[model samples]
Target: MTDKMLKFVKIGQQTPPKRDVGDRKDDFNEIYDDFIKQKAEEQSSRCSQCGVPFCQVHCPLSNNIPDWLKLTAEGRLKEAYELSQSTNNMPEVCGRICPQDRLCEGNCVIEQSGHGTVTIGSMEKYITDNAWEKGWVKPIEVKFEKDQSVGVIGAGPAGLAAAEQLRKNGYKITVYDRYDRAGGLLIYGIPNFKLEKYVVERRTKLLKDGGIEFVHNFEVGKDATLDQLRKKT
Candidate 1:
């Protein structure tokens, strides 16, 4: 443990090297390359392992930064990915689009100390991407089936998170969205560079495969009202 903590002190910070802005601007491919094994270890070793991790504090989802960072440094990537995903409903998605400069990376203790911040966002992306590549991501496991059914109004992030949690508890779910595609902002609103369409499609497919029904091109106000939906449910 002492050696682990000391590694942070010795290893200076580094981030995933980004492609030239001009080269990246023309296409929708991911902006930064995935961190190779050595690069990931180097980057993870930069975390200060602070007594108070401000990175976690400032994160919208409050991810367990230090634990995952330590795990990453130790090359226990699968455990790191699991810990990262515990707080975040979609670690892979969040790792891609979240504005780290304004959130977690911005508040990193090492960054505040004038050492460069640990590349938390890139490491997160690496962890989840690796997990997916290794087929470690599995479908949600429902313990028992329930009688009550739920109708989710949107296919956006919040709606999807709620649907996943409720479905895990065995609540029947039907998602209604105005757009033809299920993901509200994820499919249409976000630019391809930040998120590939297939990534969003995969999640939508997962929810569908999990047995959540989706009603597309179905506007609530036009097709039905609050009272109507309530009565239907």
Candidate 2:
């Protein structure tokens, strides 16, 4: 495990290549290219595999950073993806949006020791994105349906995550949002340059395929009161 690791001294740090400025100006899209499999494994090998993984310590989700990094370095990408998604609902989204410079990569022990930090975010993104491409990402499979139903307000990140977890436990979930389309901030608020709409759309589609219902353009105060909604659920 440590063989592939601790190569930060030799490998150096690298991120996925950026799109041309002219092309970026043409339309809104992700600026950075995805890291190729070889590059991802190489970058993952740069991890020090420190005794105390500050990367996971600083991460809000407390992901198993070192383990997944080792798995990635060892070319066990499916296992890497499984570990990455265990704690985080959307590793791909977090990889794109999370402020890694101030979190995981920021506190990297090697970076502090003068070697460049491992590209944790890019690795996370690559693992999940590759999983999606390989059909590894699938809908929630509930064993037994629950009698109680749950209504989640807002089709944003938090709401969607809650619905997914609840659905995994076999609860009937109905997400209510004010916007006509799902992904309130993701669909309407965030620019395509930062996070593409299709990424959010596909995630929404997965949730729908898992049987989580969405009632968009419905206001709690206008469409129905809290009491009425609670009673219906």
Candidate 3:
């Protein structure tokens, strides 16, 4: 297992290509081009497969970074995607927004020893993107319908993720948001350079497709009392 990894001595660090500064200033788009199959595999191969993976521990989400990296290196992209998605409700979103320089990649063992980190974030995105393209991503399927219904308070990542998990366990979930659109911060706050609105929209659509109901422009306090809402739920 370790043999397939630890190619850092043979391969230098490489990340997804970024648009030039001049082009970047012209419009709002993702700054970095995605890593192609070969480049992603090559970068993933740089992982040391250390006895202890600091990358996972340092991740706020505690993603199985090294395991997915090894799976990517071995060309097992589907397995890599499954492992990557196992720990994250929104792996693609985290892969884009999480500051890897301050977390997973920052704590990589090989990176501390002078070999550049394995480009973990880029690889994470690539795995999931590949999964989507291959139709490996599936709809939410509840085990059994629950007698109880739950109301979520926001439409941001936290609320969306919560709704997904709750729905999977057969709870009827209704997300209420203040804005006209769902995705509270994602739709209105973050700039497109770092995170695109369409990416967030695609996810919102998926949640709707998966049966998570959303009530936008809904002010809980003004529209209905917390106690009233609680009773309805």
Candidate 4:
């Protein structure tokens, strides 16, 4: 495992290929292409695997970065994806949207050491996308359903995360959103160049498939009061 790491001394940082500007002008789809398997492995192998992993520390979610990167270098992608998702509910979403330069990748130890920082965001994206392609990303399986139900207002990022966490703990979850769709800002605010609508749609679908319910196009203040929502829940 040690032999697989510390390759940043020899390897330069790299990200996924970008679509041709001429072709991109016509579509609202994502600009960066997915990293091929070989590239993902090679880039992942560049991790310094330092005693103190500043990348994980600086990440808002504090994900287990080095372990997953090591797993990717070792060709254990399922394990890598598992570790990545353990701390982050939506690795793929964060990979695409998170300003990693201001956070995780920015605080990388090797970047300060003069070797370019590891392509952490791209590696995270690759791991999750591969997991989705291989069917490793699955709906949560609750062993027991609790009697209590939770009402999450607004299907924005925080609300959706709260709903998923509650559902994981066996509570019945019902997400109420003003829009016709589940993802509030992800669907209406962000552009496809940064985050495709399908990604948010698929994640919301997974929550529904896991037995969570969604009440769309229902504004709380207009439709009902807080007390009424509580009673409904």
lDDT of 1 by residue, 1-233 (tens): 74665355778766677889999988988787789987887778777788888999999888999889889889999999899988887888988999998999998877787777888888898998898888877777667778899999999999999998899889989999999997879889998888888888888888887888899988999999878899874
Model 2: lDDT of residue 22: 97
RMSD of 2: 0.9
- What stretches of model 3 exceed 4 Å from their correct place? none
State, as a TM-score between 0 and 1, how close model 1 is to the true structure.
Answer: 0.94
Model 1: ten consecutive residues of lowest lDDT: 1-10
Measured against the true structure, the TM-scores of the candidates, in listed sequence, are 0.94, 0.98, 0.97, 0.98
TM-score between candidate 2 and the true structure: 0.98
Q: What ordering of candidates by lDDT runs from best to worst?
A: 2, 4, 3, 1
Per residue, candidate 4 scores C-alpha lDDT tens digits across 10-90 of: 788888999999999999999999999988989989998978899999998999999999999989999999999999999
lDDT, candidates in the order shown: 0.85, 0.93, 0.88, 0.92
Pairs that collide in candidate 1 are none
Q: Quick one: best lDDT, which candidate?
A: 2
lDDT of 4: 0.92
43-85 in candidate 3: lDDT tens per residue?
A: 9989988778999999988899888988898999999999998
Candidate 3: C-alpha RMSD to true structure equals: 1.1
